[model samples]
Target: MQLQTPHLTLVLISLLSLNCGSWAQSAFTIDSVKLTLLPGNSVESGTKVTLRCDVKVSHSFPQLSHTFTFMKYNTIIYSKNSSQAMVERSFTPARRSNSGSYQCRVTIHSKEKSSNTETLTVRGLQTPLLRVESNVVNEGEKVTATCSVPEETGPLQFSFYRNQQMFMILTSNENSTNTSVEFQESGESDLHCTYRHMEFPDSSNSSNIERVLIQPVTIIPSIKVQPGLEVVEGDRVRISCDVLGHSKNGYEVFLTDRETLLMSSPSSFTHSFEVNASSSGRYVCKVETGKTEKISTAELFVAELLSRPVLSMSPQQVFQGQMLTLSCRTLNINQERITKADVKFELYKDQHPLKEGHTFNFTASQSSNGNYTCRATAKNITKESKQLIINAKVPVSPPVIRAVGQVIVGKPFQLLCESELGTLPISYTLLRYQRPFYTLTVSGPQRSAVFNISYINHADEIHSFTCQAQGGAYSRFSQALNTPVIEPVSKPELSLGFPRGQTFTEGTDVSLYCSVQQGTVPVTFFWYRVGSSRPLFTSRSSVTRGEHVIRSITRDHRGKYYCGAYNDAGQTQNSEPVTVGVNLAGWKKAVIAVICILILVLIVAILVLFLKKARTPRKRKRAVELSVKPARPKSSDPMRMSLTLDIEDNTAVNNTPGVMGRNVWSDHVSDSESDDPGREEECEKLRYTEIQPQQPNNPEEVALVVEECVIVNSELQDGTQEDPDHQTTDSVEYVQLNHCNQNPE
Candidate 1:
């Protein structure tokens, strides 16, 4: 026999493929289940919830040998056994009959189903009432309080507290049933409130502790300022008040400063008032006694008086062997309680008495020259000050400062200054190296002072010239004329103090300051290098300031570089052409920091190979051999049903829950349709067909998917199945399964 007829046709095709996979898993039923909940069914009573149980399996049995229980209202509450098509249960403080009905049965291996019972309410939050429109409050009085919560709990959030801390948070309005607040006392104790539910964890319990007393603080009325409050502006101050023990026949008093009220007395203990100068501020002293009113403030401070006597004179003009100083101080305008009294000064001269106390030393003659007058008598006031004349003069010799012309390079020169005799009208001053430049004032009596000297550079050749001669407070100087050493050459400027866009690479250091804004010193400076004619550096600077450093910069220190500036009046000035390029060295910045660390390690290895191919886990889509057909070509109302699928492996096609749509799919597909190859060949010939309608203990029926439409072709549409204008006309045929989180075993 030909190989035993091919091993008896492969054992009858392996016993008809194990009897068609045991009749596709015993004609799989137990199709619909679901019971979810997890974080919501309106929870909150002590929190912790869960519940799960999924199990719907039958898209040609992609896996489902279940056994989950759960229940809740009919009792059970959790029983396992899973090949898992989903199962869970938690609870934690969840009671109140764990909130009514919840379902979830499942079973599968022998059929069973259940689900849809749902409910779960669990509320519980209500404990916050805190009231107090009054329980005694009178320090600065106001105390309101309120709080509430428990109007069937919904939009809460209050907070208040006080002796236990918190203090105010009442949000105010979401149907605001309570949550007031005024609080003003200085002593209270225990007050509370605690509503919750705004960011929910549903809190509420802390509200019945009201104890609040807060009363103390009424004793004010004391004001007493007689010789006090530091008065003194014509002082006679008295302001008293004292009503703390009240009585004077229903009191009255008054006296304010919180913006004026000044005086009102009647319950007098004293209230004189004199320290004026706008009485300086904060006063008060209330009293009232009728509806309980007692104030008391106090801060006065007046001061204001003296204002005058100043007189000063040291050397205001007088010379004959010099010596004269006169001073007389007073100034009070409120010398803080004014007290330095015994002062007495007198000077007069054209009117006779010459001098008496608060400082007066004299020696200048012409009989101590004239028109003086200073008086000042304190304690009883007498102020005179202001009248000083004093002209004693006579003495002016040392002058003779030279320099007269033609020391040229540009003309103009004349200094002259002369005073070798004595006072006629002095005041000269010309100095140069000692720096005073020029001054001349020989009023009317002529004592000589020329000073013309127009412009001469080279720092005027080491300057030296002097002359000075005043007369009254006598002044004299001279003796330093040696200035005239052949001067003139000015013009030299060359700068490069570097650092400004600086770029000198190879071993750095490049200084260049060759100066001479007006030229004078030994100068010299020279630097060149443009097209090179020699002289790359040379310095001298006796003071015209010069410099030129280079330490290392190679390639002949790059290009264009000017500088020049010579002196000794020999003339030379060039500067203004710097250039020197070529930078980035240090081994080319260490090879550009090692090529920017290999281009940031090749962009972090291409972003770690695109995040390890986006955290791996892909390659799946293996089984694909679909071929279905079911035709129904051109026929308008024949109730359409044209299906023709032929997938073999452009794999990846999914639609989960019993495969494809029976009305619930669209979590908007596209995980890029498994890397899109035309959407993975239109998701490998997608297909769907639907027709559910078999209730009897409903477990959500309609299954058998390959993306759905298992096989249909009917036509019905003319409303009336209990009309709400009902209409119908169905004809389907779809397929493309496998997606329930994939690995469906």
Candidate 2:
């Protein structure tokens, strides 16, 4: 019974006409109570429980309000007032201490009476009982056993047992269900469990005694390969023996190299141990899991670390391609099978891998002479051999003794001694008979080494150095190699185009010649301008063929010039500058002289005509001048004449000169007058512009009359000079007589 609200009396008064009982007015009474519990419904120890209480209410009770008391057997466990029309009591789940009868009593305020109590029997699964469902178990399989219940209406609690020892206890549950205890794989053992109630008066009980018999679990131990087969001291060697598949149970693990045991564990486990020189061996392992003690033994060969293998030569140093047999060995190693030795030998020369071998027997090479060592690779181990230095006694490769040259005095010239090839790891001691007179150190591991010292005044035998390369047991000194004590290449002195200090003109007799003072090898000549990039005047080119041939020169073109002498060895020296200068003085003077002569002739004729004009009737006469072409004029046209002034040049001078300026004269007036004979009057009367004075005096320059009444004595104006030398020819008078003017002024 329960109360819907706190004011039960006030609610009953509002609904009822009057009070029936004197002491219990407005209070409802319950006639009876019944509590029914579901099967397997109980609580575990230290847990909660719920008791459902149903009350019957009719018209006899107008309103109901009640207080309830929860009882265990005959004792009152709890008491409380009902907050609703029905009453429900909550308690901790069933446990051993709480296993007893549970009942609830209700007092009704509406009926003004107490109801009879209802009871429920609570129970729980007991503890300390172990069991297994299956009769037989296989290896490497999960081991399973469930807790059991003896006899009870309450929930069950479970506990697991293995090998007669308690392993785990399971929480209680509702049914007479099979609770399991699991193992990865079956092992020789016993199994059981305990079952109890899930809810309370915290009450519980356990199930019956059960024993589990597992069949033989076959464990086959498998070998495992440890990582880093090659290692140094203090490295961990981990070995494990685990049963394969379901046979993981009942196995013992062992660690070994081959057959020797290093570690062991009672069950499947990994065994790790730090290793050192004393811990080298072949390894395997075995296990005993069940009925049969599985025997799987592996060979563990303990390693006895030996000294690193070293490669050595009987004769340390020798000539290139000399017979060389490098004997290599690691001390204290059982070398029956070099493979078992577990150490590989590396052959190194010139700081590079020459070969990888167990032993060495081969010819030495020029390239083979360098830092050499033998590296022994043991099983997961490395040891560098002691320097076996095969001093191939390469005589230090003649100490490629190079002499240092300088224009300064007393500055010690270093004679670099180097060997391109020799036995390796060779230190060099340089000895020169001079201040720094004693031995000086040099670089090397090879046959060659370098030695440097100051104040080496002996240029003659300056590089006379004795260099020794000591390798292994062999040592040898080298004969000094001389660098030919050559002087540095000097700029070849050059002279181009004849007369020096002038420019070169095109189409002139340019002689590009270069020479050097005391030069080695026939100096190859090259010519270039002052500011130009490459050589312009090359050796004997198609364009530059002739020597000087001009009697007197002109200046149409010119430029700067320089030259270099060289050979395959290198550039030698630049020759002294030779510049050709051309003034065109001769050309201008000759033109001026011819024009002056023609003027004088015209003046004389004009004077004679003036006198004759006074003497004669003074009749006007018209004249025509005709000019003929050089070769042959067409038959329809009259032959024409053109004056060509040929200025000769001095053939001895071959220098090129810069062209300063030029003067242009047209022949149109003379040609038109000559073509028309009737125009001779105008031609005779024509007064041409006067010729300029000769060019100023220039060094090595002379000017004079080149030709007068310039005739075609040689050839066409465009043709080549008739001859390089002078050839005198008969001259015809070419006097222009003026018929228009005769004066005596």
Highest lDDT model number: 1
Tens-place lDDT digits, model 2, residues 430-486:
666522234434443334444556654433554555665554444556665454432
What is the C-alpha local distance difference test score of candidate 1? 0.62
TM-score of 2: 0.30
* Candidate 2: segments with Cα more than 4 A from true spot: 1-424, 430-466, 472-475, 496-513, 518-524, 530-534, 539-554, 557-559, 565-578, 583-592, 599-745
lDDT by residue for model 1 over 583-679, one digit each (tens)? 7677888999999999999999999778446423221111111222123223243222223233222212322223222222222233433445675
Give each model a TM-score.
0.29, 0.30
Please report, as a residue range, the 10-residue window in candidate 1 with the lowest summed lDDT. 711-720
